[model samples]
Target: MPTQPKVIFFDVNETLLDLQPVKESVANALNGRKELVPLWFTTLLQYSLVATVGDRYADFGDIGAATLRMVAEKNHITLSQEAAEAALKPIRSLPPHPEVPAALRRLQRAGFRLFTLTNGGSAALQDQIGHAGLEPYFENLLSVESIGKFKPHRDVYNWAADEVGASPKDCLLVAAHGWDVAGAAWAGMQTAFIARPGQALYPLAGPTTYTCEDLSSLADRLVD
Candidate 1:
């Protein structure tokens, strides 16, 4: 049997929060080209990795605005810096997935220590958690900004383990991004992949310890 984790780390963004509002906002900024939102998001993530690889640390929000501008420029849409920032403003107040609150309650009741780890900056993370009323759910809101790297960087996971005083192997990372699952696994942690729409596991990575359509299902598996 798989060992039960003593600590559970959740990735923020699309893992716990629904990003549709932000997507809609970006779509509007793209001149109603809703189809471009996904591409813009992809570019945002891509540049985040670029920043990490180059040893340059920028807040996640700044990366988002810059990538939004890049996407707009590529598609021949003129986007001002202020407009790009405005489009990403919804990220601070995203609603949780319908199943998130109840699922978190179950996990907490089951005696698992929970924390949120994200690539967002400290202030942005605080605003997000507070605005979503999720502050009470986690013991801490950890950001990669502390270590000057992004997720999927081995150092970030190791640093997170140190922050919570837990051994990497004794913790489980639950995330909607396959790359995140892979990173945690590589960093010597267990992983649960939340198979959100349009998301899939990276075939090149090792198998995830658990795969569920949503957090409620994950709770069903974790809570007795």
Candidate 2:
């Protein structure tokens, strides 16, 4: 059997929590538009990449606000600051996917230490984790805010490993986002791809260590 990881770092957002409701909310808020939410999310990610490539950084909240404004303007919807902020509020209260709690419980019971790393602000991440009843499972909740950079950045993954006192080789990163897994792998951590449908794989050079349909499957691999 392969040796088990000493620490497992989970990605927030679509990995553990479902963002569909927030997407739908944004769609409705934009007057029944179906693709506005996706567009906004894509824009948010694009800007983060820009920041990274340009050696600039911005908080997730600021990126979110700017993305929302751009989306609204593109769709010819005039939104005030209050409206933009309100539209993005659902991010903090997104419910965990149905498979999350049980899987996390199983992982905890199996003696695997857990932690989280997200691009979301610390306060927002705390609210979402608390709302999903997942706060108890994590040994630590880490955010890119602390490192002043976003994921796919080597520093964030290095910081997470250091915080948990785990060597990169002994840490496993679990994430729905391919880019995150790619980054972790590049940082010398093992990676498990939570293959949520419709998400694409990152064009990284090395293969991921494992792929699963959801957290439950991932937990089974970790504990078995």
Candidate 3:
């Protein structure tokens, strides 16, 4: 039988919370130009990685606002810092995906130490979990900002293990993103890839310990 992890570290955005609200907010912010929503999000993720790769640290919210403004400029739109911040303000209150709450409860009941290790900033992460009513579901909410790097960086993964007081092998990272799964596995932790729609494992990485269509599917295996 495959060994189960004592600690299960989750990626917050997209993995746990539904980002459709952010899309809706951005649509309204752009005067119904929903087309810019995806572009703005992509730019946000891109710049986050850029900062990480450059060995610099910036809060997730700050990077998000900067990218929103950058994307707006690229498209010749006038997006002020206030407007960008307003658009992203919805992130802190995003609702959990339908399957997430139940699945998380199942994992906790099954005796797993559930924790959140997000690339999001400390204040934003606290607001997200509290607003979603998910604060009690996790033992601890961790952020990579403490380490000055982002996901896919080895430091974040190893640091999470240290915080949890577990060896990397004793923890499993659950995430919807390929890079996060790949990073955890490479960082000496086991991984479970939630194969969310339009997401696929990276071609360069080896297989993970588990791959499921959603949180419920993963819970079905992890929880009796």
**TM-scores of all predicted structures:** 0.98, 0.94, 0.95
Q: Which ten residues in a row have the lowest lDDT in candidate 1?
A: 128-137
Candidate 3 structure quality by residue, lDDT tens digits, 31-132: 778888878877877888899998888999999889888877777788899998999899999999889988998898889999999999999999999998
What overall lDDT goes with each candidate model? 0.93, 0.87, 0.90
* Model 1 deviation from native, Cα RMSD in Å: 0.8
Tell me the number of clashing residue pairs for each predicted model. Answer: 0, 0, 0
After superposition, the stretches of candidate 3 with alpha carbons farther than 4 Å from their true spots are: none
Q: Which candidate is the best by TM-score?
A: 1
- Cα error, residue 89 of model 3, in Å, equals 0.5
lDDT digits (tens) for residues 43-88 of candidate 1: 9889999999999999999999999999999999999999999999
lDDT of 3 at 213: 90
Candidates by lDDT, descending order: 1, 3, 2
Please say which candidate is ahead in TM-score: 1 or 3.
1
Identify the candidate with maximal lDDT: 1
Instruction: Report the C-alpha lDDT of model 2 over 166-200, residue by residue, as the tens digit.
Output: 89989999999888999999999999889887787
